[model samples]
Structure formats: C-alpha cells, structure tokens
Target: MIDLLKEKQAVLDVQPAQSGASFAPVLPVDIEARAVSKRFGDTPIFSDVSFRLARGEATALVGANGTGKSTLLRCLMGLIPTSGGSVHLLGQQANTATGRELRNMRAQVGLVSQKHNLVPRLSVLSNVVHGLLGRRPGMRHWSQALAPQSSRDAAMQALERVGLADFANRRADRLSGGQSQRVAIARAIVSAPKVLFADEPCASLDPSAGEDVMELFFQLVRDEAVTVVFTSHNIEHALKYGDRVLGLAQGRIQLDATAASLSAAELRGLYD
Candidate 1:
C-alpha cells in the first residue's frame, strides 16, 4: 500500500509558506464566511450567517427540515452563488474569483453530498481517479486509459485509506449503499482537499451502517488532517461525531459551541 503520510508530504510541497513584507500572512482558518445570506427570488433561505472552519477540525451543522442546512453547505462550497455577503475558502474569495481561479480553488476543496454521485458503470478505482480530472491539465475525463501512474497511485492510496483497495476493480453499482458512500469519500480524498464538505453523508444508510461510515469518515479526516464541514439532520450523529456544532433554526444560528459542551437534551430544545 502507498504511504498516505508520504503522499500528504508530497501534496504539502506544492503549498509553500508565503513570505516577504508585501505579502500578508495567511489566516489559520480554512474557511471564512462573513455576513453570508442566500435567497431564491424574494424568499430568503438564510440571512446574516457567518462562521469559520479551523484547520483539521470538524464542524457539524444541525437543523430541522427547511432550515437551510444543505443550502448553506452548498453556498460554502461555492456550488451555488449566494445572494449577499462574502466567503473566503482556503484564502480565495469566492465572490470575485475568476473561472480558472475558482476551478483551481475547487480542486483543493472536496464535497460529498447525500447522493453518492458516482459513475455507476465505472470501477471503484476509476471513479476515484476521476477526482484528478480537474488536476490533470487538458486530459479527457473519460479516457482512463491515459491516466498517469501518479494519478493511479493517488487513487489507490485513497481507496486504501477508505478500506476499499481490495474492491478497486468492482463496478460502483455493485457495491452496497454503505460501500458506495465510502467510495464517494475515497473519490473526495483522492483530490487531497484541504477542506471536505459533506452534506448528510449518512442519510441513506441503515443505523449501524451509518454509524460505521461516520466513524470511518472522522478517522480519515483526523489522519489526513483535512478540515471537515458537514450538515446532518441526525442530532445524535451530529452530537457524537462533531467537534463543534452549529444549530440552525429559522434562518439563524441558534446555538454554536463545542459538541462536548452541548447535550442532546439542549439540542432537542432548539427543535421545539
């Protein structure tokens, strides 16, 4: 198996520390949102929201249905344009970034949503290799035949990290729901994103399977030192897995604190 730590070191080599008097020091925050809001026509989804994700930490967003948790996550990932405010992801301003800049910035950010979003017909390893498509200049996405050895190594390493290296050749559609989710995560990690955004990652799994997936996800993030921001409707899962929790209600953050400092009983009160 490829050494994940060594690969991580190689990845870090590309990210040299900035210096010189004219260059401003970079913020430690991996993600920063200030006075952010989202709306569809006249209907406001959320307003005046702000938060920061510290490096190598996991922040969970919890709320009832219609509370805009997913919408807010999408906004942070720059998948959708926000109605107001500003967002800086990995020090790149989302609002004014050019297409090429956004593309490059996006390569450093990974996302896993409720849907597995895998190409069912492809082998699990190939699906993970797709994560490098953007990173590979002028390469045809579907031409897996032309994938370089480095890309294959990274993909295999990602699968190894997710405990799916043995199933690299299996078709994505043949995997179980839980396995599919893991594969999606492997795809996300193959990109070696500094920040990983998961939207209700366990929503489709059975209780036991969901718990297992959550455990794997948290461990992977911790080992890889990737910052994570995820939204979950499962209060127990959020309280159990998150280092920090942000409770959203009626377009506002009703509560924000370390998960250890908050109890399930207190979180339930927000729902009522």
Candidate 2:
C-alpha cells in the first residue's frame, strides 16, 4: 500500500525561506496530556489518562467501542473541556489559554476525523483551502466560489500531497469514500500544522484503500515533523504504525508501552 502511494507522488509543501546559516534546533515535546479525564454528568468517559508525544512521534489509542478515544482526542485539542487534569500543546495550557492566544495555538493544530466534513457542493480545492480560514479571516468562507490565488495555489499543493490534484475541480461529493478521506487529510495538513489528531481515519474504507490512506496520512505528517495522536480499531495498524501504543479500557489506561514491545494480542485483549 505504501509503495503504491509513493508511486503516485505529487508536490507536498511550500514554505517561506529561513536564514541560510541557522542551525536546526531540536523541537520540544509537542503534546502533553497530564492525567486527563472526561465525563458526562455522572457517567465516566475515561479517567486519569496521561501521555505525551514528542515532535514527529505517533501514538495510537485503541479500545472497544464507546471507550472515549475520540473524546480524549477532543480534550487534548481543546475542542471539549476535560473533567479533570490538563492538556498542553506547544507549551501552552490548552484549557487556560485565552482569546487570541488560544486561537493562535489552535491554528497550528489540525484534525481529520472519520467524517470527511467537506461541503458536498464545493470543489475539492475550495474545501482544502478552508483550512486557511484560521490564518485568513473577514472573507465569507461559505459563499466565496474562488479563494485568493495564493490560497488556491496552496490548496492545490495540498491536494497534490494527497494524490488528488487532478480532482481539485471535482465536486467533493463526487469522490469515492477513500478519496473523500484523503481530501480531509489534505484539508487538515494544508495549514502546516504542528500537531494533528485523527480518529479512525480509515475506518470507512476497504482494506486496501484504508491501508493506503493510513500510509499517506502518516507520510505527510512525518515529512513535516507533525506530532500525531490517533485512535484506530485496527490494532495491527496501531502497532505497526505508531511509535507508542496506549490501551484504554474500563475508564483508564490499562496498558502503555512502546509499540515494538507489545503484541497485537496484548493490545486486543483490552477490548475484552
């Protein structure tokens, strides 16, 4: 699957020039979730979940259905309030950051979920360009048929990253399930995010397409040194693709270990 994706390579990114002589410094830890917990009134979602992902590292959350994997990702990304503890991204407390500070922090993060979350009637390029809405405002996002040339060019580059440049003019709803998911990925990464959150990114595709999407997702993030925290029902993909594997069950992290140290059977046992 990875080989196939590699064969269909397209342009990936465009970045501003930096100092020619500056040394590359090691990036700090990208995500820090300390004893994070979530609940709905009296019902517990998950409890005391603590973990960290260094820059460019990937961690996969695995458990049975209704185990709060998605909810935890939301908490880390500041989309929802955690019942207890805190999540820090890029050294700022996610729950405490306020106003423009919070917006700036979130602008550097991205999410790709099971749902493509694209506007059906919009062209694929327009949907991907929506990612820049964080960086550009005051323009009508929904009503604009054509974005600024720079935004369109960037969005096209993003589509190329996902092997969908040729489909840029196609209506989003016209694409297949796998293509839609890839478009979602392009939209998420178009902003050059420092961290990305994905929830079951390949759950809706067939085995082959699912693997290809996962590989593409991983490659794009790794190429730009984006930290990733994703949840997956496929234990094998989690173990094979993630540097660290975390098992959540019965409202807590039952197991946490390097992916290389844990077998698929051990991770699967958390579901039972």
lDDT leader: 2
In Å, residue 44's CA in model 2 sits off its true spot by: 1.3
| Per-residue lDDT value at 70 in model 1 | 91
Clashes of 1: 0
Q: What TM-scores do the predictions have?
A: 0.87, 0.87
Alpha carbon deviation, residue 56, candidate 2 (Å): 0.8
Q: What is the lDDT of candidate 1?
A: 0.83
Q: Please report the TM-score between candidate 2 and the true structure.
A: 0.87
Instruction: Report the error of model 2 at residue 174, Å.
Output: 0.7
Model 1: weakest 10-residue lDDT segment is 1-10
Please write out the lDDT profile of model 2 over residues 1-272, one tens digit for every residue: 22222232221123356868786786588888898889999999998888777898899998899999888888888888889999999889997788898889999999999888999998888888888887775464442365777778788899999999999889998999999999999999988999899999998899999999999999898898788999999999999889987777888877667788667766767777
Candidate 2: regions farther than 4 A off: 1-27, 140-145
Candidate 1 residue lDDT tens string, 1-272 = 11332243345336577677787545489888899999999998998988787888789898888989998888887888889998898998886677899899888988887799999988898888888876775564443556877788889899998899999989999999999999999988887889999999999999888898999999988988899999997888888889888878778776667787667776776676
Clashes of each: 0, 0
Clashing pairs in 1: none
**Candidate 1 at residue 19, lDDT?**
75
